[model samples]
Target: MREQPPYLRVADALQQRITSGEWSPGDRLPSRAQLAHEFDVGDNVVRRAQELLITQGALEGRTGSGTYVAEVRPRLTMVRARSREERGGSPFKGDMASLGKHGSWDSRTEAKVPAPADIAARLGIAEGDLCVCTRYEFLADGKPVQLTTSWEPYDLTAGTIVVLPEGGPLAGAGVVDRMASIGITVSRAIEAPEPCHVTDEEAALLGVARGALATTIRRTYFSDDGRAVETADIVIPVALGEIVYEVPINL
Candidate 1:
């Protein structure tokens, strides 16, 4: 195997400390110059390491301020199509409770008009077909973390448990889990990841500066027979949250 890069080694060192509980959440880390000197590497190398940690949800950096450890832990439990696993049981779990109590929701609202061509294509519906759309902004510790819009066919979603008037059922339970309860298991999830800039409208909703770096994850859920049922577009602040996957090599 190839040797790991210097920056990656640096990231691994920091990751070990975070995982070991040596560096608790909300803790400040060393400055770039300080870390560079400690690791005997250039500042660029240290910066790269920091970037990796941020992407992994291990660290977060304020624009003018210094870097800090993120309070949110990584998810450990395995999630299947039809199971409700408790996230509190794991050390680095992604519990819905982690979203924070003070984190507010502006109340989910339905889409007034037809979805755009792109969204319609993903939902497997016509461009002008009416679709049920709900927009939500998720926050952590009073800071906007994610902006998402979930879409489904109007006929299938209208007045259903999936579209509750207030505090929608899709709030904390997640769409996948809730669907499983209704006998609609998401056997497969297809995600497309791409870099995106915070639009003016999105920035206002997410309470972030315009042009901030973000990751757009368009996820499509399918049943065991490969029938697509729902589509969700999630925009996450690159500096705050991370998308993690735990893949087992031996299936």
Candidate 2:
């Protein structure tokens, strides 16, 4: 039989300690050098072992602090009302309603931005296409909860009243309603969620430690003709909340 590699062997040993209750949740483990000596491996090997545990959700790393046994994931929730049938208003408002909390948002709009490759694909626009970019910081009960940057094709809204997103009369209205006002009826929205680590900028705004886990959502709003009208990247810290999707069963 083939033998396991050094890092895996070291990680296994640490896992044993955690499962045996010797290292309790929220308890910091030995320093990398100490673990290297304990396992008779190099410091790099111990570092890899800790990374493995972190990826498994068995451990967590704080940028300036040491790694610790993972605690129960936070219970914060942001509800996703995927369908119009499930939605009452904007996603922020919907989330507040689900949690029985008050919600507010601050937005800044930037115009004449050229759509990058990924965004162009989602918005079905050409590369370097002019667009309006708006960044939103949402707060629930005076605490920052979610950050999103929305992009709208300039060619689609160049001379329209809602082109600036949060500047028109219907400013702050959602993509669904905003598009509806502009002769385009948004038929549906799709969201794809993935796990990621907090970046320095996000960590500062979301008030979480850098390297902390977070949920990144890529959302697209579609029109009646099935063309994408708007696209956004929404990031929510794992420490602040979780997301619940209201998916229905169709036969």
Candidate 3:
């Protein structure tokens, strides 16, 4: 059998500890030199091991604060819409059923102004449009899992069912679902995924440190007749959650 790379072996050892909860979230990990000595390997090997964990969202390094275990949570799956011909016998179903009950929307207010230029363009709206943004911080297994923000056309969403008791639509049911009830079916959903640094405001709401690694998914929903309806920006802390996508292979 081929020998396993030293760095990978070291990373596996650390990962085992993390998966076993031996090192909890926010717990500092050993320095490179210490890890090197512990594994009887070179410091470079330990550094490589740390890098692996960082990319895997299992660890994070803070400038001057040292490396630490990242909070871990179940990965969230993003399923692309299937074409009509590819739908087969059963149509594609959203996985909201596994996301637990539609919890009460906890109101989180941010005084920040209009949507950024890029976001406004995605929503096909004028720049500097006065918007009321409602945000909800979701939790799973008593840990922060996902942070969601919804931006609506200030005039249209104001004093409507959209701004009901929980503020915004119910959980498990996205903006598209709520809009469809009023004869608006989301025909197109444009999504962009990119790596981002957590801002102070986002960190506070997501319970993560500023500058922490995160995945930002920006989604714009369009009506069946091709009208931009709503736009949402969701940020998932790398450690706390992962975006998973699976594609089947052909025979």
Candidate 4:
């Protein structure tokens, strides 16, 4: 068997210390130089180990201070159920409310963006077709929770009252209702969730270490005519929450 990498080995050792209660939550760690000397490893190796721990929520780094054990917080529970969407409004905010946490999201929309090959295929539009892209940062109780990038073909909603997802009179209304307003009935939605590593931008926004484990969901809403009306990629950090899909079985 291949030996564990130096950094990983150090990370495991540090994790063991935390789990064994040698280091309690909120206890600041020794300086990187001290840890390097103690572990007989280079400073870079210790730094990498510390970063790995930070990403796992075992430790947190304070700006200009030092690394400390992270205070435990209840993991968020995110649910994906058909019933939630049927109820209308923002399912995310409702879900958070159900858990007694406030939910809010910040969104920025870019219009007339040329679709990339991948997005074009998903939306069944020609490559370079104009699209409206909206990026969202979702927060729970003012803490970053997830990131989403949504895309809609420009021609689909152009010259309509709901052109901008978060604008117009129907602002903040969900996709199902928004499409219904334009006489398009959204029949179904398909989602593909996959495990991934957090990118630098995602890490910065989610307040986790780079390369942290995460889940990315590629979701698309389809109309009754089998046309894809909207697609979004949502990224959720593993350390922050767990995702649950609730399916209702007809008895």
Top TM-score hit? 4
Model 1, 1-251: lDDT tens digits are 99999999999999998989999988999889999999999999998898777655577666457778876533222222212333212111243344333444444767445878987888777887777677777654455667778776666556667654234545456555656656776677787878998775775455444566888889787777776677888887565566665554656
Residue 174, candidate 3: how far off, in angstroms?
2.3
Candidate closest to the true structure, highest lDDT: 4
Using lDDT as the yardstick, the better of models 1 and 2 is 2
What digit string (tens of lDDT, one per residue) describes model 4 on residues 1-251?
99989999999999999999999987999999999999899999999999888777788765557788876656798999998788888878888998999989989999999999999999999999999999998989976789999999999999999999999988878889998999999999999999999896787677677788999999999999999999999999887889999989998
The residue ranges of model 2 lying beyond 4 angstroms of the native Cα positions read: 1-74, 83-89
**10 residues in a row with least lDDT, candidate 1:** 75-84
Clashes of each: 0, 0, 0, 0
The reply for model 3, stretches above 4 Å from the true place, is: 1-105, 109-116, 163-165, 168-172, 246-251
Q: Per-residue lDDT tens digits of candidate 2, residues 1-251?
A: 89999999999999999999999987998899899998889999998898788767687665456778876644567667655333634657766766878788888999999999999999998989998999998888756778899999888888889898888787777887777787998878889999999776776565556577889999998888999889999998877887888777889
- Lowest summed lDDT across 10 adjacent residues in model 4 is found at 55-64
Q: TM-score per candidate, in order? A: 0.56, 0.68, 0.56, 0.75
Error of 2 at 177 (Å): 0.4
Give all candidates' CA lDDT scores: 0.67, 0.82, 0.66, 0.89
Ranking by TM-score: 4, 2, 1, 3
Could you give the C-alpha RMSD of every candidate to the true structure, in order shown?
11.5, 7.6, 10.2, 5.3
Q: Which pairs of residues collide in candidate 4?
A: none
